[model samples]
Target chain A: GIQVEQSPPDLILQEGANSTLRCNFSDSVNNLQWFHQNPWGQLINLFYIPSGTKQNGRLSATTVATERYSLLYISSSQTTDSGVYFCAVNGFSGGYNKLIFGAGTRLAVHP
Target chain B: EPEVTQTPSHQVTQMGQEVILRCVPISNHLYFYWYRQILGQKVEFLVSFYNNEISEKSEIFDDQFSVERPDGSNFTLKIRSTKLEDSAMYFCASRTRRTSNEKLFFGSGTQLSVL
Candidate 1:
């Protein structure tokens, strides 16, 4: 079993501001995903970066598998981005592909 | 794009009653999973189905919980007897491949409210 811990726990940002959320895991992982849980509670997949860095519009994520940590960056944040961000991971052995999610980072963007 | 779709956005049932949550995963995907999130809590993995059999499951998925891919398109989870504690948002997710680093597309989720 792996434990995933998210940083800040919560965050508040103003429109156009940028922020970074982090996730650290206790054991080795073969998969890592970042998700945004909107106000309506829909878990939307943002990134599936097991390693390396990836960008999608204003969102970007980088994972250093060697250190067992990942970082999610939101640039020029918007009100619509206000929600909970989660990081999930899976191991190479047991629990592989079966996700274990972090508590999440509650983000509130004020207009 | 073909995304996961769940039925009955919400479900309400009495304790001791049976309830089935239905999900239509992406047509081309082979792996299906069920995860439950108690309100304001973390998402807990219930089970993972692949090749028409359960590949893994958590302790929470007891005798009361079962999963079936009755048809090629739909995956269903059945709870023999619903309990108040069972009330939560159950999400259905699927991935095109069973390999690591693959993205799992999840549905809006079925909000089960057991009374």
Candidate 2:
């Protein structure tokens, strides 16, 4: 089993500020995803980046698979962005891949 | 977009009682999974189902827990005897492809509270 670690266990940012969240896995992964668990407890898919960089609106993510690390960037943050951000990876297991989640980074974007 | 749907958004059950949580995964999805998140804890994987059978399960899934795709469209998780620790937000997820790179779509979740 692969161990997933997320940094900055807790973060508080003012609206319009920028922040970066990092995730590091112990082993190589074939798939990785970023999720936002909103205040309502719905896990919203942010990005499924196995490698390279991808941008979606004010949110973007970069995964350096060789380095076994991924970074999620949030720019011009808003109050709506307040929630727990999670990073999950699909590491090989029993001839298949299982999604393993990391302890989320709780972000509070105050206006 | 198609989404996974879960029933009884919140449930309250007495300890030792049998409880069943239901979900309807995306119609085209071939892989289905159940994950749980205890309050203030990380989301944990419980089981994954494909080809109408379980493909992989975590230690969290024990003899008291079981999963079934009773019908072509409905997926369910059953607990023979619920315990106080069983209370958590249970999520149902689905993915269209069996490959590793495919993204997963998760249902809102069922908040089960065992007393």
Query: Which candidate's DockQ is highest?
Result: 2
Instruction: Kindly list the per-residue Cα lDDT of model 1 for residues B1-115, writing each as its tens digit.
Output: 5689999899999999999999999988999999999999989999999999998899999999999999888999999999999999999999988875677788999999999
User: lDDT per residue, candidate 1, A1-111, as tens digits?
Assistant: 789999989999999999999999998888899999998888999998999999999999999999999999999999999999999998886744788899999999999
What's the true lDDT of residue B92 in model 1? 98
lDDT of 2 by residue, B53-88 (tens): 889898999999999999899999999999999999
Model-by-model lDDT, in order?
0.93, 0.94
lDDT of 2 at A67: 98
**Candidate 2 Cα outliers beyond 4 Å, as residue runs:** none
TM-score to true structure, per model: 0.95, 0.96
lDDT for A100 (candidate 1): 87
Best by TM-score: 2
Error of 1 at B31 (Å): 1.5
